[model samples]
Each structure stands twice: as structure tokens, then as C-alpha cells.
Target chain A: MEITELRTPCLILDEKKFRDHCNWMKDKCKRLGVNLRPHLKTGKSREVALCQMISQEGPATVSTLLEAENFFSWGVRDLIYAVGISPSKFSRAAELIKKGCRLKVILDNVETAKALSNFCEKSHIEIPVLIEIDCDGHRSGVKPVSPDLIGIASALTDGAKLVGVLTHAGDSYGCVGSKACRKAAENERDSIVLAANRLKEAGFNIEIISVGSTPTATFAENWAGCTEVRCGVYCIGDLVMAGVGVYKLEDLALSLLVEVIGHQKEKGWVITDGGWMALSRDRGTASQAVDYGYGAVCDVNGKILDNLYVKLANQEHGVIVNRTGEAISPEDFPVGTKLRILPNHACAMAAQHHSYHVVNDGKVIAEWPRFCGW
Target chain B: MEITELRTPCLILDEKKFRDHCNWMKDKCKRLGVNLRPHLKTGKSREVALCQMISQEGPATVSTLLEAENFFSWGVRDLIYAVGISPSKFSRAAELIKKGCRLKVILDNVETAKALSNFCEKSHIEIPVLIEIDCDGHRSGVKPVSPDLIGIASALTDGAKLVGVLTHAGDSYGCVGSKACRKAAENERDSIVLAANRLKEAGFNIEIISVGSTPTATFAENWAGCTEVRCGVYCIGDLVMAGVGVYKLEDLALSLLVEVIGHQKEKGWVITDGGWMALSRDRGTASQAVDYGYGAVCDVNGKILDNLYVKLANQEHGVIVNRTGEAISPEDFPVGTKLRILPNHACAMAAQHHSYHVVNDGKVIAEWPRFCGW
Candidate 1:
């Protein structure tokens, strides 16, 4: 099937760009001498996961249990359920572990740790767990020097083992330039390494030290104490990555294939079938230096259209307008004209669709399915 | 099953509220003497569609062909593919028409109208088409007064038939107060009625005159010269609707059931399993009179937690903080405590999940499946 023949408002994965990005990240990890546990949270496709994996041996970080199950079914044995485990999901995690999937769950609170321990004891399972260390006060995770870290570690008494410390410098995404990103990366590395050292001094076996975020993984010059890096969005770079100078515009591997259905010429707008439902409602780049409203408009061949951006979007209709306030003629972009849209955040945009029409050299090479629900 | 037993970060549909909202819209349409062709674009569920239908006979408006097909399978014979029709979907639309589905496609451009006409001529099936009228300069649609309106209508030849004019006052969503919403509704009613009159004068039989929007349909006291009012979102009220004064907080039918995962005590933040992936990245209420950061925090029983809002969100983590910077003790809302969140936009949030866990009087009554994809 050809690219144009596929339905409009569907996700298009640029195969060549995707492979290039994966290879680039692999090379970066190799140079840094850290195991690259690519987060499957971005693509959530078994095929994409295979491309991201260091080898078929299978070790990956998944944001949700559904993703963990998906990758495990695809023969990914070593998986990390990256989100903090609540009591409700303990049995589900135990079920996956019982199925011979070496799953590792993470948490920062003593209550959840004790709950996991209790669940493990009842289920007769020894589940490996990681303590989430907060590097930049971004989202989840405990402070590197928090006294409760030991309490959380001690609470893992029955069948729950303290595997290591994990930290995600999500605040690295907010860093504007290379200097700031590098600083955030250093902070990320130091905090996790500090937590690891503290655990070691306390006589706990801190086997793994994991830290990452696409921005930090790409910009961090040093990964001395970290044994593995977890990055997801780097495989499908977006405007947010570009905005933070982690990846260039040409590095973005995902774009929404849409068609111009109509035009509001008076407003210099050309309406397309892709809207928030297609492009996603992620305005990640809104606070960045360059705000691509909805998404940056690109031609069918993946060439960025100058000054044209998806200015506004309804459920299934996107209004593309020229940033220069120049009127766009309806004759110029007639109805049925196919176009590509580079999204603001690849992860969020990709989540909107079930599968991607993989395109290489303007032709549909394959279709890769992705899992969605919690 | 109980509400607390269901997984975290999942959609919750309040059955009683949903039935009430649907009944209210039904009565409103009855008072206006217009058919209520509830747009299924919001709650894309067969059961919800059945409840929203004026009669079991079923006539609705869908934003995508996938929705039309889904509803068609559920015995919804009449469906209007409301978004502007492009050529690529012509075959799919025709396939549905051939299956005894009275599917009406809409378009605002002459090019697409010609393409539809060409496709119908070749397919040997007369497809009903509606010319989209721009009620407000918000999104897609041709201006009602433009000569291109008749041109687009005239392009329908061979197997394509011009049914009437359809317009959605999407800008009414931006209106803060009832006065502005009523004015927008007036514009929506006038523009579509004007287009219908023009088409009639040009020797065309205008059968169905359609105009609507949630805000407009809720506030519009007048619906003269319109055969049917197409409105969605009102069926599943949200923070965006509440922000516009269309629905009160209690009227919202959909809420996200999430678990408290962790906390940032210094910042007085309580992190939960719900994030943008669950609540949606919509921020539709950001520009409204009251900005709900991500979503409004609610108790498990559906009571609003005053001043507590989702201040930050990651892919699987939402941080709830007090608006007045008051500290919340971790013990007060411990880990594993389930809570509900009212989304900013129901349509966007609903699209993130696969199904809604129906709750009534604090119990899981049913699980309603929702289809997503295009």
C-alpha cells in the first residue's frame, strides 16, 4: 500500500528516521558504557521495542503494566514496571512475574513498599523492586538524601528485594539550552549516584543504578555511576525534544499523515482531517522557545512548510495557518491534498493511534500495532 | 465489582448523571421542536448512543468514519459523518451506504464535492451530502453568504445529492457567559438557515437543516428553521462545560478514578496514578474563567476537593496541589486511596481510555466499551 492510500489522520512512522534514531541512541549508550534499557512507553510496539533493545535478550522499562504484559508476550523477559506500584496492581504484577517475566516494580513511599512486601509474602513471590530517587523534584520519587529511603528499603522484608535506585530527571525537559540540560543531567547523575552510595554504605546490595530522560540521556556527557539509562521519546523525537536542543527537527521519526479537506482562505487557514484526536492535545512546546501550535505543518514528503502551523484544532479538524499572517489561497492547497504534521510530543501523539503506517521513501512499508489502555 | 476494585486512572461514567443529562437534552430539543441528533463524537459507545437517540430508530452525527461504522453495526441506520469529507474516505463512505446505512457526508469545498460526485458516479450510488456553513469564524466551514456555497452544492451531480446545510458553532465553546453563548447560537442558527434558504432558492431541495454545539444547544432559546440540533459533550458534561456555565460540577457524568501513588510534601503535592494519559492533555479550561490545571480534584464519592487541583502531570503521574499553598498531610490521603477527577474536556479524556467503568451510588454498575480509531 502507498502512503497516500492509507486513511488520513493516522500515525505515520518514518522507518528510516526511526532506525537512525535508535542507532544513534545505541551508539550514545555504548560510548557512555551503560546498558540502554529503552523505555517502551513511547512506541509501545513489539517491533519498535525489538529495534530499541540492545539485543533480543530483552530488558525494557514500561510505564504501565499493560505495556509490560505486551512486551512480555513478545518475548521481552526482563521488564521494569516504571510507575509507582499501588496495592491494587500488586496481584497483577505478581501474575506477570508468575508467568516467568522478570518484572521489577518501583516505588518511593514506605506504605507502598510494605504493601508490595505483604502482597509478595501472600503470593509466595520474590519480586525485585527499585527505590525511585527524586533528582530534580520533577514528578515522582523520594529525595536522594531522605531518611525515609531506608525505611522504604527496610519495609521490603517478605519476598520483596531492593534491587537498586532509579531516577528520572523529567525536569531536564524544562531545560532550555544545552548548558541547562547538561547541568540537569549532572544533577540527575549525582542524585541517583548519591542514593546508590548511601544504599551501599548502609550495606544494601544496590546492584542497579538507573537514570534517564531523553534530554538528559542525549546531553549527559558523563554517566559514571549509572549502570543503565532509560529513555523513550528519543526513538521518536518531537518538537519538545527539538525545542530543548536534544534532537533536531530532521530527527523526528513520527508525523501524522493528514489531508486538506477544506479551506478558510479568508483567515489564511487550510483545514485538514487531523485534529487533537490525530495530533494529540500535548502543548509541550508552548512554554519553549518555539511554540508549534498543535503541530508544525509539513509537506507529504516530510518537508517542513515555512510559517505554516496547525493554529487551531477541533476534535477531527485541524486549521493550518501561516504564522506571518499571509493569506493562503484555496487554489494553492486544493482539497484532498495530503500533508504530514510533526507533533509537539511524539509520545502523546503516538498514543492517540492504535497502529502506525510505517513509511520509507514515501511508501507504506509495514503497519506496526501499539497497545493503549491502562 | 465495586468502584474501588477497578484499576486506577480509568474512566468512570456516572450512570445517573448520564441519564439525567441525556434526558435534559431530549427535553430541550422537544421544547425547541427540533430533532436531537446527538453527536456521538464525545461518547463513542453503542449503549450511550442508544440512550442519546431520540428514538430507538437512531440518527446521530459522528466525527469519523470509524464511529459511523461502529454505530452502524449497532443498528444505527442514520448517521451523518459530520467532519468535512475528503476523497480518500469516499470508498469507505460508499461501502457503508451500500450496507443500507443512511450515512450523510459533509464538505465545504467544491473540489471535494466534485470528487464525491465523481466517486458516486463511478460507484453507482447516490450519496447524501451536506454543505458545511461557517456559523462562527472558529474552524472549518464555508461562509454562508459566499457564492462558493452554491458552487459546492451545485457540484453534487450523478450519484451525489445535496441534502441541506449543517453548521457547528464551535466558537460557542469559547464563550464564557450565557449571553455570549446565546449570541453565538443566534449566529449559528442564522447562518445555517440562510444557507438552507439560498440552496432552496437555487432550485435545490433542502431536506435537513442542522445546527448545534453543546454550549449553543444548552443556551439557545431559539431553534427556528432548523430540522435537527446536533450536540455532544452535553451528554457527558466536563470542566470545560462547567467553566462555560453550561453544566454545574454536579452535572458532570464522567470522572477519572485514580489512586494516590506518592507525594511531594514540601510542595504540598499529592501525586496520583492519573496523568495526562488518563485526564487528557486538553487544558480546555485554561482560557476559561476558571483554569483547571489538568483537572479538578474530587473525592471518591464525587464531591469536589476544594482548592486542590492537578498542578502538574507526566505520562502516568499527576500532581495535585492546594491552590492556597496549604500543606496536605500524607496520612490524610495515604497511598492506595482512590479518588476521582473531573476532566477539563470529556471528549479528549474519553478518547484516552478504551472503556468507561459505569458507577452509580458508589458502585461499579457496568462497563461500557468505547471504540477509538479512524
Candidate 2:
């Protein structure tokens, strides 16, 4: 069935663009002499991950046991549990390792590592693991110079072999342009490399040194010590990337195809059936220079109004507040007018919908399904 | 299992409180001498709808076709597609009507009505509809005094029967308390009644008079001209109700239970696994007197700290900013401390998750599955 006929408030993903994005990342890795083990936390799709596998050659970074299991089931042999493995997930990690899955869990604390060690020893599950080093204090990971890092490594090393160190400088998302992004990426690489050397000086053989973020991975000039780079948003750029000047509006591969359900002519609101349901509540662009309140509003022909943005949104209702002209209330665009909305964050917005109607040249050729939850 | 034991970043619904809330609204309808047909848009779950169904005979109000179809499949006979119906959804409405689904659709334009009429006539489908009257300058609905109303109704009432006139005072959400809310409710009722009277003068018998919104629904003192009332949010009341002083914090039936996965003790930031994913992107409480950035940050024991709130959120990361503390950081909470977050809007937050862990006495007795999409 044609996409236009399928109804509004639907997810659309382009296969050609998705593959091109994957190839672009792969080419960058080949030039840098590093492995491109893209993260699955961005697009939790087996098909998308398959592209990453084709490009990377081996394991990919995962945030959940579900993702690890899904990718493993798809025949991706090596797995890197990117996030800090909690006590609850230790058993599941052991189970996957016991089942012959080549899983390398991440650790950042002595407490978590001690628990993991106990579980592995009891379950007889030998697993290779990496220490998550904090590069820029974005979310989780131990500080590069923290004394607790060595303590945790020693604790977890009883049953799990320390493969190397990993770091994700998520704060690089705040960089204004490619130059700033490259600087941030360099800092990210240096943070991990320096930490690896410190551990190496302490008589530790660190093989894998990883650091990644879409902006950093795409713009980083030098990769002195990085072995693997983990980036995801490059596969499906969003408004956040556009705000950071990393990617243009045209480069964004995903959008919610919505209909002009109603309009508020008095306030310049173009209401659409696509609410937080189709487009997730992730306002990643909020902290950016241009806060696309929710997202960029476009016309039926996918033409974004230069003076208009969705200022406010309700459940299944979007208020497109125009910066110019008389306020066009919900009356302006009567009904059944199609529109394409550029999302704040491609990952979260895409996660809201079940499947993406892969579109290219105004035609939806296939539908790719996405899975949710841990 | 206790909610605290379940994984962090989970939705917990209080069943007993939900039942009580339903009964309270039902009793209010009995006192007002109006049929209480609730708007199920707030509690999108059929489980919550079935709980509310205990009050009215069966059937309910829905914002989307998916909800209507779900309720219908659950043996609900009379259903109102409360949201505006565009030409695109005409076929879906016609099919439901043809299958003996007594569904009433709402429309605001002659252009749309003409299209719907043509489709219904060609398909031999006698669809029942309600002329949507705008009680206030809020969201969707045609103005009661709009000249286009009569013309659109006359054109569309060919194969379709206009059994009612519906108007919702969504502006009631802005009102302070019962007095303001009551006035808004009266305005909502009066606007629809006036439209119905106008239609009656034009020889159109308007049988059903619908008016709703949680605030207005609760304080609607006079529904003399209305036959049925539609109110949704009161069942699973949210922070909006607390802001309007309609309900206390303890009265709220839904909350997101998250765990402290990562913390910044120096910065007073407590990062959880539930960023926009589990808690939703709806900052409904952002506008309230006490702006809970995402939701009111409560301790493990469910006690809300007026001094602390989730000030900033990223994908799977919530920064707990303590307003009164020297440095507000949730990292102060132990790595495994579980916390409860009361969402700003129950409707939007509830839609983000797949299912609800039905809780009673702080223990999860059963799990209710939640369906999404149209």
C-alpha cells in the first residue's frame, strides 16, 4: 500500500538513506583504522544492527540484555554491554555467557563488579568485560583517575577478564559545529587513551580502547589510541543534530507523517493527529540554540515553515506557533492536510511507533519493525 | 512482588484508588441528572475503561479510532469518536458502522462532511454523527455561533443522522478551582445547548448533548440541556488535578517507579534509567505553580520532597535538582535507591509504556496489558 493512503501519524524510515548512513560510518572507521561498533540503543532494530554488523565486522555496543539477546540471536557473535551492568542484570549476563554468547559486560563500580564476580563464580560463567571510564561526566562511567576504578577492575577480574576501557562523551552533543565537535571527540579519545595507559603502566594489558558519540565519531580528526568507535544517531539524524550543526534538515532520515487534523487561526496553530504517541516526548533540542519546542512543522508537501515551529503539544494535538504573520488558528488548515514533522530526537521519536514505513522518492517500499523494552 | 522490587523505570497504577475515583464520578453524574459517558482518552487502557464502565452501563468516549475499536471489541456498544474525524478516517468509521458498531463521529466542516457523506452513501453505510461545537477557543471543535456550522450539518446529514451536539471546555484546565471550573463547565454546557437550540430552531432535533474535561466534569453544576457528559482524567488523576486543587498528591493513581542508576554527588544529579522513555516527554507539570521539571521527585517511601524535582531529563537520564540543597543532585541517593515520579499528565505518560503493574497496598497483585496505536 502507498504511504499517502496508509493514514497520518505514521513512522517513515528510508532504507537507502539508512544504508548510506551505515556506510558513511564504516568508511570513517576504515580511514581511522578503528572498528565501528555502532550502538543499538539508538535504533533497536535487528535489520539496522545487521547493517552495523556488515560495517563493523564483529560485536556492537548494547544498553540492555534484551538488545544483546536480540543481536546475538541474529548471529552477531561478539557483544559489549555498553552501560554499567547492575546487580539485577548480572544473572542474565551470566546466562547469556553460559549459553555460549560472546558477551563483554561493562563495569564502573567495585560493588557491581563484586556482585558480577560472585555470580560468575557460582554459575561457572566466564565472560570478558570492559571498564566504563567517565570521559566527560555525561551520564555513567567511572572517572579515568578514580582510585575506585582499579578496585572495581580487580574485583570484577576474578571471574571476568578485563578486555579494555570504554568511554562515551555524550556532552559532545552540546558542541556548536564540526570543529567544536572534533575538539570534543579528541577530548573523549584522550580521556580513554590516557586512562588505558595509566592502567597499562600498572602492568595491565588493555587491548580494547573505545570512545564514541555521533558528533564526535563523525568529526574527530585524530584517533591516537581508540580501537573501537560506537555511534548511532549517524544512522538516523534528527533535529538535535541540526541544532548542533552536525547534520542538515535534509540529512534527517526519519520523520512522523502527520495530517492537518485541525488549525487555530487565531494563534497560528496547525494541529495534527501526531502527538507524543507518534513523536516521542524527547525534547532533545530544548537545550540547543534553537529549541524546536517539540519539532519543526512542515506542510503537506514536506515544506517546513521558516517562521513556524510547534510551540506547544497536547496528546495527539500539536500547536504550530508561527513566528510571523497573523496567528493561524486550527481553522486555517481545515482537515486531512498531510504534513511531515522533523522530530527533536530521532531515536526516541522513532521508538514511539511500532514500524517505520521505509520511504524513498515519495514511495513507501517496505516496512521495518522495531522492538522496545529491556 | 512489591513495586520497589520490580525493575526501576516502571509504571504503577493504584487499582483501588482507580475504582474509587470511578465511583466518585458516577455518583456525581447521578446527582446532576446526566448520563456519565467518560472520555477514555485520559486512561487509554481498557482495564481502566472497564473499571470506569462499572459506573455507566458500557461504552465510552475516545480520542482515537483505536480506542473506540478496542472498547467496541470489549463489548462496548455505544461509542463516540470524541476526536474530530477527517475524510481519511471516513472509511474506518464507515467500516465500523457497517459491522454493527454503533459509533458516532464528530466533524467541523462542510468540505469534510461532504466527503464523509459521499463515502457513507457509496458504501451504503448509515453513520451516526455529532456536530462538534466549540465551547471555547481551546483545541478542536467548530464555534457554536459559526455560520458554517448549520451549512456543514445540513450537507453532512444526508446518509448520516445527527443525534447530538458535542462541546468540550478544555479551557477548564486553566481554571483555578471548583468555582472557576464550575463556571467553565457551565460555559461548555451553555455553548452546546445554545448550538443544539439553534439546530432545533432549524428543525434539527439534537438528542445527545455532550460536554467534558476532568475539571469541568467535576464541577459541572448544570447539565440541564446535556444528555451525556464525558470526563476522562479524573479516573487516574495527575499533577494537573493537584495544581487545580481538585485532588491531593495522595489521590493520584499513577506514577513512574525509577531507580538511581547513576549519580553526580558533586553536582547533586541523580541519573535514572527512565528519562523521556519511561516518564514520557510530557512536562504537564512544567507550568504548574511548583514546576516539576518532568514530575515531582519522590523518595523511595513515596514521600514527595517539595525541595527536590527532576529538573532536567535526557534519554534514560533524569537529573534530580534539589532546589533547597547546596547542590541538587540525585546521585546522593544510593545507587539502588528506588524513587516514584508522579507524571504531569496521566494520559500522555501512561501511553508511553506497554503495560501497568496494578498495585494495591504498595504490592503488585496483577499486571494489566496496555495496547497502543490505531
Candidate 3:
């Protein structure tokens, strides 16, 4: 069925477009001679993960255990709990690891290491953990090149198996464009190598040195120090990617299908059914060179309407403003107008919806529900 | 159970605090001689609604028809759907009206008015409509003094019935303190009255002249022309309310319980399991008087420890910084230490959780699961 016949405020995924992205990224990994364990938290759909998991037992990264549980049940074997693991999460991780899930956890401190090790010992499980490195002081992880790096890594191993170091060049998101993103990638590769060498010198054998982030992974020129890449959003580019010249609007395969409900010609505002609830409240791209207020408003065929941008959105109502097109006259878009919205941040937006209305050749073909919560 | 023993990433609601907020607002309405139609979207729990409900049937403003339906199913009678009526939502509202829900919907333009009217006509439902007036320009609604508003209100009644005029001073969120919020309330009260007067002069009898926003309702002065007040956030005060000086951090009844995961004492950053994913991506009070990045980091007992705050939040990790603590460390917190995170915005944060963990006298008395999705 066409998107118009489905329902208002639905998530539409272009099947052909999605497959192309997955294949393209996989090919990139092949050419770079590295493994690609795509972060499944971006899609959160088993079907999307399977479509993208063209090789192996489907290596993936999970933001929540709920995702790990869902993906493994879907037959995905290799998985990394990307979020920093707490003592409270030890039992759950041990349960999964002992149950034969190739579950890897990340840690940056000694307290977590002791608790994790104690929990593993009590459960009679030896979980593999990657020491998270803070390439840049963006979010989580420890400084990879620091003098205390060996101590931190040793503490994290705490009787558990060591799987080298993993670093994400998340700061690449702030890069001006592709050229800058490449530099960020090299920085990430070097940081991991420096940390890995330090660990080996300190008498630790490391097996998996992983580095990933969409911008960095997409533009990496070196994979010498990295065994696996963990980029996620490349499968469905978003407005933030477009803002940083990472991808164009045409490359966005995921968008919210919304219906125009009303318009204010005098005020140049068109109200629609898809709001922050569908698109997400993440204004991640707002600080970029070009601010996509919420997302670029488009037509049913996923064609960008010249100057229409969703300026503001509440719970269930999105206020659309046409920067061009007859100055947003009421006549420009009447009732029952089906529109598509390119999300600012795909990861955040994708999490809000339960399922994606899978489309191929401009018509919906199937439903792929996503798992949420802890 | 002690806060730490209960659960991590849980929503804790204080019964005594919530009841005081509700009673105080109702008492204020009684003193001001105005009708209090609390918006149920904030809590979205029937139990919370019952606490806020003063009248026999309980008057309320709903953001969605589903909320209206749910509340009506639980015996609520007087309700106004405060959100702008979209063409897609017209049928549902019309159906509910036919099903004996004393529901009134809002509209800002003539085209949507006509569509809603047509739906009501086809469904043989007499829908009560209020013209949404934009008083603060924060979002939604027609300008209170716009010339075409009366005509739009008239059109909606052709197939249904015109209830009156409504305005929500969302700009009150920008108010620095209670005095400014009081002014916002007066502005909201005046805007609704002016719009009602305009409609009256156009040969219409206004049945409902309403205005609200927690800031305005709690601080409003004169409710002379306003037949009803619509406020939502007061029932569960948050960091936004704390920053607005409307409530202290202690008054914030709901918080996200998170476990300490990691730390960098050298950098004075402590990481917790609660992040933007669990807390929501809204930096609601960042621009207010006190700019707590994500939220105020409180001790397990809800005590704000000096200048500590959950500064930067990732998907599943929160960076807690003790602005001026001597040697503050998540290392000291250890892996099992539990903390409370007061959210920036109550509605958005509450929406992310599956349910509220109701705490009375420091005990989890019940679990009220919240329904989500569009």
C-alpha cells in the first residue's frame, strides 16, 4: 500500500535505499580491510539489522540490554553493550554472557572493574570487555594516550578477559565537512593504536581493537590499529549529516510520514500530525552550519518542498513553515496533504516510534517493530 | 524500600508533594473565583487526575483525544482538547463527542474549522470548538486580535457549535521568576477575554473563556473573564519549575533514579546510568535562571549536594560534575551508588518512562504504567 493509504504519523523506510546503504557501508569495510559491527541501536529493528547484517553472526552494538535481548533472539550473535556498564548491570550482563551471548561490555574505571569481576566470578562467567578510550573529551571513555591508561585497563580486566581498546571519534560530528572528518578518523585510529601498544607493553594480550563513529568510519583512511568498526547512522543519513556535508537530503532513507491537517496562510504556518513524538525532540543539527529547525519538510514521495521546514513541534502537532512556495498560503497545502519529514538525528527519532513502515518503490510493503526501554 | 534498593532509571513520584501542588492550585482557583480545568497530559495517570480533580466530574484540558477518551472512560465529563485540531484528528474527536464525551476541540484557522465541522456533520456529532488564540507567540493558536479569528470560529460552528476562545501563554516558560510568571498569567487572562469580547461583538455568546500554563495558573492575578484555567506541570514540578522560582528542588516529586557507573576524579566528572535516553533529550531549564545542563544531581534522599549537576548526558550515560566539590568522584560513588536526577521538563521526561514508581512516605506504593505512542 502507498504511504498515503497507511496512517498519519508513521515511520517510512525505503527498503531499496536501506539495502543500498548497508551494502555500500559493508563494501567500504571490505575495501578498508576491517570488520563492520554496525550499531543496531540506530535502527532498533531486527529486520533492519538482518538486512544490514550481510556477514558473520551479525555483530552489533546495543545501547540497552533490551536491544541485546531482542537482537540475539533475532539470531544476532556478536554484540557489544556500548553504554558504560554499572554494577547494577553486572548480573544482567553475566546472565547474557553465561547464556552463550558473545556479549562485550565497556568500562573506563576500576570500581566497575572490581564489581564486574566479582559478579562474573560469582556467576562462574568470564565476560570479554573492551576498555573504552576517550579520544576526545566528548562524552564517555578514558583518555587513551594518558600515562594512567595501562592502570585503568588493568583494573577493568579484573580477572575478566581483555578484548583490547575501543574508541569512537564522536567529535567528528563537529567537523566542518568530509575533509575534517577524515582527520578525526586518523586521530581515532592513532589513539587506539597508542593505547593498544601501551597495554601490550604492560603485559596484556589484546585481541580486538575497535574504533567507530559514522563520520569517522565513513571517511577513515587508516584501519591498521582497528579490527572492527562500529558506525551506525550511515544506514539512514539524517539532517545533522546533511548539515556537516556528510550526506545530502537525497540520501536520507528514513523519514516520518505525516499528514497536513491545517495551514495559516497569513502566518505562513502549516500544521501537521507528526510532531516531536514522531520526529524526536533532538535538535542536534540546530548548532550546525545550517540549522534544520526540526527537519526538512517534504512531500509524500520524499521530495523536499523547496523551503518548507518544520520550525517547531510539540507532542502531536508539528508547525510547518514554508520559507518559499507562495509564502505558505493556505491554498499551497490543503487538508489531507501527506508529507515526509527528514529527522535531525536519526538515532533519537528512530527510538520514538515502535515500528517502521517499510517501503519499496514508493509503497509500503511490511512493518518492522523496534524494541525500546531497558 | 530505600531509593537505592528499588530500581535504576525509575520515575519516583511523591504523593504528599503532588497532593499539595494540586490542592494549592485548586485553592488558588477558588480564591480567584475561576474554573480549574487541569490539563491531564502532564501526569497522564488517572490516579493523578483524581487527585487534581476538584469538581464532581473533574474538568480538564487534553492534548489528545485518546487522553480525553481515557479520562472520560474513568468518569471525567468536562474536557477541552487544548491542542489545535488537525484534519487527521477531526474524526476521532467527532466520534468521541458522539460517544458522550463533553469534549471541546481547538482550531486556529478557517480551513481546519471547515474540515472539523464537516467531520462532525457526517458523524452526526455536535462538536464544541474553541478558537485557539496566540497570546505569547511561543507556538500554536491564532493571534488573539487577528481579524480572521472570529470568522474561523464562526465556520467551526456551522456543522458543530462554537464553545469560546482559549489561550496558553507558553512564553511563560521564558519568564525569569514568579513575578514575570504572574504577568504572563495576566496576559493570558487578558488575551482570552479580548478574544471572547471580539467574538461576542460578532453576535456570538462565548461559553468558555480559558487560559493556562502552570506558571500562569499558579501565579495568575485576576480571572475575571476566564471561566476556566488549564495548567499541567504543577502536579509534578521539575527542574524547569525549580529554575523558575515557582518551586524548590525539594518540591520536585519526580526524578530518574540512576546508578553511579564510572568517574574521572581528576576531571571532576562522575558518570551515571541515567542519560538523555532515560531522562529525555530536553534541556528545558538550561536557559532559565539556573542552567542545569540536563538536571540537578541530587543525593538518594533528594537533597541537592552543593553545585552538583548532571551536566552532559549521552544516550545511556550522564556526566555528573560537582561544580565546586573537593575531590568529587563517581569513583567514590562506586558502581552501585544510586542518585536522583531532577529533569528539565516534566512532560518530556515522564513520557520517556513506561510508568511512574509512586512513592508515599518513602516507600514504593504502586506502579502506574503509562501508555505511549501516537
Instruction: State each candidate's clash count.
Output: 0, 19, 1
The true-versus-predicted C-alpha distance at residue A162 of model 1, in Å, is 0.7
Error of 3 at A126 (Å): 1.9
Candidate 2 lDDT tens digits, B1-374:
86777876778888888889999999988898888888877676767888886433365888889888787777777889977787788888777777778899987767677878887788777888898888988877778887877887798746777888898887888888789998998899889988998888888868888888889888777889888888888998888888887788888888888876656656767666667766777776666786777888776556776777777776666777677766754435756678888888887788777788888877799888787776
Task: List lDDT for all candidates, in order.
Answer: 0.91, 0.79, 0.82
Each model's iRMS: 0.9, 2.1, 1.9
Which residue runs does candidate 1 get wrong by more than 4 Å? none
Candidate 2 ranges with C-alpha deviation above 4 Å: A55-58, A265-268, A299-305, A326-334, B55-57, B299-301, B326-332
Residue A358 of model 1 has an lDDT of 91
Choose 1 or 2, whichever is better by TM-score: 1
The lDDT ranking, best first, is: 1, 3, 2
Among the numbered candidates, top TM-score falls to: 1
Interface RMSD of 1: 0.9
Best by DockQ: 1
Model 2, A1-374: lDDT tens per residue? 66678777887776677788888889988898998888887788877787876433366888777888887777777888886666666777787777778889887777667777777777777878888888898777888888877786778656777889999888988899988998899889889988898888877779999889998998888898889899888898899988888788777778788877665544566777877767877777888888887788776545676767777666777766776656765555667877788899988887777777887777888877888766
Q: Score the docking of each candidate (DockQ).
A: 0.84, 0.48, 0.53
Docking quality class, candidate 2: acceptable
For lDDT, candidate 1 versus 3, the one ahead is 1
